[model samples]
Target: MSRIPRLTPARAALAGDAAAAQAAAAPAHDADIPVDPQAGAFFDCDNTIMQGAAIFYLGRGLYKRKFFSSRELARFAWQQAWFRVNGAEHAGHMADAKASALSIVQGHRVTDLEEICEEVFDEYMADKIWPGTRALVQMHLEAGQRTWLVTAAPQEAAKVIAGRLGMTGALGTVAEAVNGVYTGRLVGDTLHGPAKAEAVRALAAKEGLDLSRCAAYSDSSNDIPMLSLVGHPYVINPDADLRRHAREQGWRIRDFRTGRKAARVGIPAAAGLGAAAGGTAAAVAMYRKRH
Candidate 1:
């Protein structure tokens, strides 16, 4: 929420278009990463792969471009604070965020949004990644397993993050688009909870992957369905529910907070550590700007 020069919608659209073109023109994937056709690893985005939600970064980018008003930004910040404090996804919070996002992009060109997402990743997301989780992704790539990011964030944002991280690909909420224009509608349910499991199942079938040979990781109990689908399941920086569940199920658990150790770290303590590491201070500064 640091004040940058405001952009008119027309200027922002043009800027976004240019950025999209640049991203499109770049290399698509890392050719050096070997791929195993029958096995793959899936990962969650928010809190699992990164410090905060990718969608929140997207909202920051859009707000800077003046896509929404200050009030909307405040609402977005409040929702983000809730997520940070709870360290879990709430149905009501996701719905409110989804509705607000869809309304903002209703008449926009798909390419334009993609373009802005590229910049957003560089500006707000690059430094927020969890090194431990990233190392796990690297381990998968080294083992010749296909790596994918599965999240409820828009596909374009997921795509950008995956591409930058040199992952195989990503699966995310697909917004209905026609002739390169957003229709403000979703093609199916957001890849959340059961929907995430379904998407992974469909992908496994299409890719001819053996589920028992695959792996999955997440931080929330909400992703239990998807995690349960794979033979190897790992929990990274898990929430309270997921931590207890992982303990009960005897799954591998790792927490990359301050001490950078593998243990049953409480989410509240993790949140406090994350804040001490700058997350809370940043949120406070953002909130103060509004007042």
Candidate 2:
């Protein structure tokens, strides 16, 4: 495991508040690209649309429902606290988080889990949505383009969010189920990093949309692949690494925390690309939609 760097009190609080502030803000960045009705707009669920991570809330609900033991909750909480204050302790920490989340839902009825999601969502998740992102999603839908929530969150919860938001649907990490009961085993790799990109490509193929005409919005570096898969990529409330990446790659970047209304492209693109590729700093996760 890699050592997490110490954070000053101010920095830690700012990191935590960034997502919520973003969610409550008005839509500042407008993606004024050529709209193609046949194409899709893919939005990353966590951080991108939601104020923070949904997994944290899911784990909390599971704990309250006694799905996991007290000790397990303590350990999970400690890990989460560590991750929040410090970022991933190890490179595999994200993988571990993914696995543990799947395990948390193992053996639960899919329908039951969906109901729980609804409860969790209603109790709190509903308010966590970033209104700015929702506006963009609505824009895509109103334009007759398919809008989907692409997320690392479980498909059940992701579907719930998409349905609630009136999106076309969702593409999310699948957990295997038998007889409508979860098997606690994933169907494939956790949809992060390169896997996200692959999922978008498959979806694009299925939808018969031109890749260049599609748009993707994300905040995490893990979703870089997904963002790059589309021609119109927007980085929203971006982590430092992703913001740097976007700047370098000439992708449109939006920082809702700032007063910037439009994405700077031409000059910033060339300038950002001229800089060196920075290290993959452990990013503060924006928990949201639990979607």
Candidate 3:
């Protein structure tokens, strides 16, 4: 049997001194760590792992660095706002927001983007995690589950977070690049909605995983397809629509936003997610107001 690995948000982060220590300590940072079929848990990023979208976190960092004009930031913010609120039902909004996010990175070096994401994560995202979600990741990890971050966020950001949290690896939207230079386009469709389900399936096939026995978790209604693809589908901090859907479909639900930190986890036992929506509170406020 493959041995279980240590996959928790490095204790330093959990202790509140998080940021630079975790990333620098993870050796599996950018590599694609293979998953073992016997045990695996696929987690959606953004609101599921962290408190908000990784791209929004990255965008704010870029804006502070003067990487883009205020006008461009405004435009991106608008698209992101629409995406955050209506994305579950409006596929078009996410597409537009993703396109704009990719365009913002066009002409930038992949290496530079990595550095930026790292810095952004260190100073911002590392501490913005939802504790309940972290607990879930820990549950899977301690049980020998190869937890993977499945998100529409860029691979760099996803990998950074996964590595910091000591997860197996990440499957995210791939931006086309050559010789370390971005091609200003995606290699394929952004890994969102149905694409997310497809990515998980492809990964499962490669990892020899039986999808029927695996677990998946997410906060958006847009992830319904991905959620449905697994045996244990958890609706974490679900939006209203997703909450309603979970009730109707008899899916397990955990709402950290309004309820007490989620108790009674899957296995091995762990504390629930704490409310850290305030860590990324500023950006989230903007998204809420814009919508």
Candidate 4:
């Protein structure tokens, strides 16, 4: 096993609030647990590790490719913001957004999207890689923990990012494929909310990993099922509802946005501002829908 570097005082300070909350809610356990003799770490993509959803950025990229219309991109961004605020009530909207997003690339070769993912990963995502989250993943890697990127994004896109991050595996929502071409329809589970937990369980079982000893990190309250499955659950840069739950449940929280020596666990100011701005845009559209 490689030696995992200790967290910097700045990083440790950022996690202080979360550590305290966890200590109050439940006993603190080592985040660096050996699930198996060979197993490493399990990660949730989106806000947990990355600054934001890579798929969303990918959608923007598709817009640049002329695959998505300006109106459609606006709508997609609207639904995402609405979903983040309203939680599960926006499930239908999320489904519709995904359908529309995928419809934009219908009949396009998957290889083309794969190439786009490479560009997004290199240009957009590489710079936005959260340092604290990367450090956590690196710690797991050094500890001989096999890392996996589990997300609700399309499997092909997830695989591209996972490969770039050097993860051992990836499990994401599967889209239909016929004769090596995308049918632009989801063939299996959507891999969100509860489905994410189920997929993680399935992976653990397949890899002979002990779920009771494994660690899971996420940012949404919707991921409670998966977070509960692991022995150590670190809630990183959680949303409003998830932050409340994390406080109540004693989940550890880490704030990576502020690089400040004393940042708290709740949403960072920039993220809150972005969500507000995104929500305002969604509200305008939603109002237009009502009219």
Reference-based lDDT, each prediction:
0.74, 0.64, 0.69, 0.63
In angstroms, give how far residue 283 of model 1 lies from its true place: 30
Error of 1 at 149 (Å): 0.5
> In model 4, which residue pairs have backbone atoms overlapping below 3 Å?
39-145, 39-146, 40-145, 40-146
Sum up the clashes in candidate 2: 7
Q: How does candidate 2 score on lDDT?
A: 0.64
Error of 2 at 99 (Å): 2.1
State, as a TM-score between 0 and 1, how close model 4 is to the true structure. 0.73
lDDT score for residue 163 of model 2: 69
When 1 and 4 are scored with lDDT, the better candidate is 1
Clashes of 3: 4
Off-target runs (Cα >4 Å) in candidate 2 are 1-37, 78-91, 258-291
lDDT of 2 by residue, 55-135 (tens): 666777778888988877786676656654432223366566677888888888999999998787766577777645655
Clash numbers, per candidate = 0, 7, 4, 4
Candidate 2: give its CA RMSD in angstroms: 11.8
TM-score of each: 0.79, 0.73, 0.78, 0.73
Error of 1 at 209 (Å): 0.9
RMSD of 4: 12.3
